[model samples]
Target chain A: MDYDPMVMDDAESLGPVVKISQADNVRVKFELSNADLSFANSLRRVMLAEIPTIAIDLVEIEENSSVLADEFIAHRLGLIPLNAEGAESLLYSRDCDCDNYCEHCSVKLVLHAKCTGGENMSISARDLVPAGDRMHQTLGMPVIRDEDGLGPLILKLRPGQEIKLECIAKKGIAKEHAKWAPSAAIGFEYDPHNKLHHIDYWYEQDPKTEWPPSEYVDWEEPPAEGEPFDYDAVPNRFYYNVETSGPLGPDGIVTEGIKVIQQKLAGLIHELTEGEGGDNYDGPRSPEYGGGGDGFGYSTSYGGNGGNQSAWGGAGGTTPFGQTPYGGGGNTWS
Target chain B: MNAPDRFELFLLQDGEKKIVETVVNGMSNCSDFTIKKEDHTIGNLLSERLKQAPNVMMAGYKVAHPNVPELFIRVQTDGTVTPREALVNALKQLVAAYGQLGREFQKELALRQYADQGENGDGSGAQGGTY
Candidate 1:
């Protein structure tokens, strides 16, 4: 068959009903109907890998005497979910017009902790203060708190130990690194269907009754008549469950996942139909979740999509978990 | 297809506030709800499943005091819809997607199984004759 990249079909699909059974900021559940398996799988895939989240991709450690190694600390910081509320106003570092890093593309976080006396100390997310006004000015502090309203514990320090570092937070997908994943758990399953049958308790209570079975445990009151008891079977219907780690709420993750997928599909359609001039393709951009921008440009690199990072080439210890081994330095690069 | 008799299941202490004793149930713990200990399985299953709900505000479960065996499951919505309603809707979405995946798998299996037939030019699978 000739190469025809099918992004979407012309035929309209039926709309599914969304019934919320429980909800909070990070966890949620709902029942959906009329949707097909394709939609649910696509949604799961998108939720897991497509959603854009802000995470510390680059870390520069200046001084470290703490128990945890530099890379371990960096990994912990990388996994900390920043409040990505105003991320839309910022461009992907690669896409920004700046030659390298810019305020519009990245958030700089600085953490300097030291303990000189007495007992060991604790360092948490609240200590990593946002350097510039971007996140603080636009989205507020990027730290997320636990259910007890405490910041996520990043590391601990003993007396006379210190750790000073800088982190660059950027927008990226979970496919690149799970640190950017918005949800902790997301799953669904076919609903089970079963029926109950009323037992003749009066007859079954007799020891000699073989028809009703005396051995069967008798209920205090006979069950109301209804469908006969049978094995529960998986039906076409499903039960959905979602839990968020931080950043976006569970409901927000699903909504954003669907929107992100739609945008990507549209972008793909435009690319296929309009040839190589994808830059000039007029397909609609996915509206950003909270505000600021309209276009959803998929960047290939963690750096703003098209920006240069040759100066810090040696700093590229790009691994699945955030790990960068940089020689100790005191200068903060913009 | 809708699941019959969809309901919230929870195990509450005799005098404990229903919300506090359980895991994260919603944005707040003001509702008084209870369920049989036997039905705890339903909550466990659905609790694990609901984490995938779209736009979920929060998702978590608490089983504090194991000796007492009380399980708390809370699903907070983003306010786009109520918690319970979101659960039903999400399930439908999942079922739909799974169905599509099954059909695609079958189609792919059939093609792979019949690949040799197409090579023989029987017009059963892959078209031949030109590059």
Candidate 2:
């Protein structure tokens, strides 16, 4: 909020004009007008990967005589979405000050299911009962389910089969594991007419018959059906259909995602103007190239930056660049 | 392969965490900035906004590799505004954009909730049609 740009805030004058066309319990439709695709994709990715949610991370099986394996049942438990209404207060297990995991970082949930008198019974997520001391918790008696109040069917059990386990639910982002993802569906559409040629339809006969334009074409002008297409059309509008996975509502997910973006940008702003009068901190001035604490690695020691290593830091040892190249787009929380 | 440190995104390490490493050309009034642990989200947003800033000649960005998180941005200004000023402008815009977005979303959510309460099962509003 600080780092005064000192100029007439023209970009702020334009503002990021986003409008919610419709909103409900599960989904919200919005239109971002006069903005770049980068911002659109950033919002989508942040909501998908940055916003934290509560999921079962550690499962201690006490008794398992059901048909499914322990790990299989554990994985299924991890996928169940608990109400993460106040997940922000929950500490990540790695960042907690406790020895391993304490009540401050994780919640203890017990799942005990037995087929007493049924031919074949289905153990559901409704059976996982919360048993912890989290006064700050907002999802105390929570299991996402349909309007019929029936939780997801986990596994089937025989007449005498029973399963009992203690699950530790922790806060996590989707980047580390997909089970923590808060959104059930996210529809991000730009350039629906394919005017930008971003999509390549592999049609043998006709591209039109095989690949019709996205239904979003009806929202805009449809490019006038046969108007001469301009190859240089940058998308100035984006449509989003965001649906939550019961942990957070549609608006909650979006607002949380927007907050994450703000935090990232603010952190960068703070670093950029940390020690100097930010007004004059014009360019990158890293005179302290290889200072203390190379805990990141020897790559922090730039003296070994030779001209030989691969550009992308292939399986080779090191590159001229200071950091090691990785394989996937990892979250900062990982 | 060893994964890059996850904390590299925030911890302003001296040797690492080159948030923005810019090389300014004195003669051409252009600069190239390399931001670490970032993807196209900020890259494209800043470049597009920088291109629209006053006294800015051109702005563009590219990722070094699909596997790497680094991003490269090249900006040429017309001497009126420095490259850093242009970047700051873009950053400020992004901040305001997100701020407005959050407020608008929350506002719309409240409005819908209130409306839904008044009418019973009024699912008349058509959403951005399911894909």
Candidate 3:
């Protein structure tokens, strides 16, 4: 057996035997070592903005006499996290053959709450339930629940006030709207003790007190006071603490983030190889969801928006008709 | 801002060479390449990976300006393989590594009996990792 460098880049070469140190429903913590900072940052970016999740994209309110405006209520609904366990199995509405939206692409949820008594009634995510003719499993239901009925109150209804609405949940990436974000905040840090001085700290009295050292200082050796910093050092290991918003699990977010990044690279590789003439393309192009192959169909909303700003002239948005680079088997890199 | 912007980096233009080979001013086997519409994401990662190859003499990348969405990578190899081939291999390896990581995560999840979602167990809300 010959030495396979790639396979050999396992536990020993990885330099750390650490596992995901902490994990729960809404958060996950892990260490990424023997990796480049760019790779770590890229993964963090994808998890924050590219990983897809289900959210209330379109809402239709039938009756609303509550104190809150219809738009306000709808906006709150959008922030609520819906279980996105099998969101991968659902097709982007644009990719589906249906005219508007179908069961294959959209999940309909309805909220009905009325305050008929004198006491004020609270409207929460728990009040929202599956609404459809067919079977609605727990997969797409809201994940948040508490003693006070899925607490994270949307609004309070007064006596004689009522609200009735239907929500259409669709798959989308955070790049489209933050409502689809998988995590609220991704705690990413490297060189915790500033051994490399990647950043220059400002100070009036003491730099330590002014810009307090990262709590992760314990992870790295504290730079000796007044010791010369390593000018040529580059960030290699990283710490990732992902706080999910409940739409997806932290594990799901991390795994899906990797898959999305692979798809992006696969998409680019496909373009690169196809441009070089396909016969020599030996890179793996696994057909995964949203992958340029497999079931990977790039939805229009998957690209840039607002602060993200990486439109690339809209990767899947401007394609001829609705043909995505991954969806069209006949389409070339052209 | 009139900047090329981040997401615009991913959109490849027609007839545009994503990666281009340019002759170094007066060096043989030493090459400088420009990856259009990219940033440190590709430049830094690819350069770091290239440096690990025994054939690669030196590898580094830089961006001319924050506004410019171009990645400049300079690679010199020890006369065995072309810098272009080294770059392509390193890039593909990075992708493969990501795939490997995904499988490891799934394996861990499988050990935990798989899909233990909705537990929403309370207490210990403190954030912790590598501590």
Candidate 4:
């Protein structure tokens, strides 16, 4: 309960890491200086809502003989977590130059199936096929998969039933929809303080007082002096957990979430400082200006704007854009 | 730790060691585990470190559910290394790098001198030099 001005100014730089532990690749635990709880919570929110992952955004159904309706099927498809390895290189639809959908901004997946035999069958995400030029990398890729190689079920079909549909996957954040959330669950808690109380000594003197969890008393080697219990203490340090929804590993989700936070901070700094003093205001500074330890205390040498690397990187391409998600009246059956 | 079990002991604020157990090992491409603590800082830090590990294909962690307070992390790695090994390496590397950064900061502070030469001087922090 002592005042320390230095603690507020450079807690990040000066804080000590007291402990760290991990359970293989699945979970890790670490303890550092207790700072603002809100700041720690912000990191959790960023991981759940800001990290970019690929999900089905627009769907066009040509035919449906299965039980699920077109809109219902689209909803199910949107929740699938696609492999987002190269998504950072791709541009967000809002940032793209195209008026609507384009190859640079979207991936096309088609699913066509029919039950010809007498036996009923189940349909899974594996049945969905990535179409067009990007097929090689995306074929048989599920939005998410379990360790057993099983994907979420899309629909079940009886004999003679069929379904044909086209889905467009795009990079987005969970703020848009739950489907884009990188993690299914995430949370953190404050570290607790413990104290030993000499209950036996107090009980012997005052027999009227009652104690719960009676086994806690140390009868074998009772100390001459009682240890003070810190029940009222509020710990500043926190621990958190992240359960991945499958498109990426939990670690990847956290890393991407941190990057997104850094980028947003960088964007703010660029916006506020760009036109202030320099008449040489370039159109828009690359988000990379925030790199090289701009805001985050550590050095991040991830050069080159940290955006998409392939098709989306180009500007003024002749590739024609497709119809808007809602502008087109109905699905184009072929 | 057996093939199905891996555990880590977390040193709590009260100096009590709590063991976090792995309930589900993602054999093919995932691993799921639980910890008693409710925390975002540790999970975020570990995941951030894992992302920088070499040969790590994908790494992820999450709370089990909205009602549950346990944490789970799953990591996938290239054939060259196991996910568990990759995570340990990441933590070691981060500690070393951060320690080095602290020393660098101290050195810079010692070498540089602060001056308050008023508004007459150009305020730009830029220094001119031939690379």
Top-scoring candidate (TM-score): 2
- In model 4, the Cα lDDT at residue A233 comes to 45
Candidate 3, residue A300: CA error in Å?
22
User: Candidate 4 lDDT, tens digit per residue, A73-144?
Assistant: 899988877876456555556546789877776788899999988998888888888886562264225754
TM for every model, in the order presented, reads: 0.50, 0.75, 0.71, 0.53
Please tell me which model should have the higher DockQ, number 1 or number 3.
3
DockQ of candidate 3 compared with the true complex:
0.21
* Candidate that beats the other on DockQ, 2 or 3, i.e. the better one: 2
How far off is residue A70 in model 4, in Å? 0.9
**Residue A284 in candidate 1 has what lDDT?**
19
DockQ of each candidate relative to the true complex? 0.01, 0.23, 0.21, 0.02
After TM-score superposition, what is the CA distance of residue A19 in candidate 4 from its true location, in Å? 5.5
lDDT of 1 at A144: 56
Query: Roughly what TM-score does model 4 have, to 2 decimal places?
Result: 0.53
Model 3 spans with C-alpha error above 4 angstroms: A1-18, A133-136, A209-213, A276-334, B1-44, B47-84, B103-131
Query: What are the per-residue Cα lDDT tens digits for candidate 3 across A1-334?
Result: 2334463356325532224656655667777776667778888888888777788888999999988898998899898888776666667775577999878878889988889899999888887888774223654688675765574778898999999899998877675578889888999988887777777887898887888667667777776777886776888678889887776667667766876776656554544445455332232111223423442222322221221111111122121112221223424322
Model 2 residue A74 lDDT?
91
Q: Return the top candidate by lDDT.
A: 2
Best by DockQ: 2
Candidate 1: where is the Cα deviation over 4 Å? A1-14, A135-140, A193-235, A275-334, B1-131
lDDT of 2 at B125: 40
- Tell me the tens digit of each residue's lDDT in model 1 across A231-308: 542233445677778666565566556545433333322223333443432321222221212232322111221111
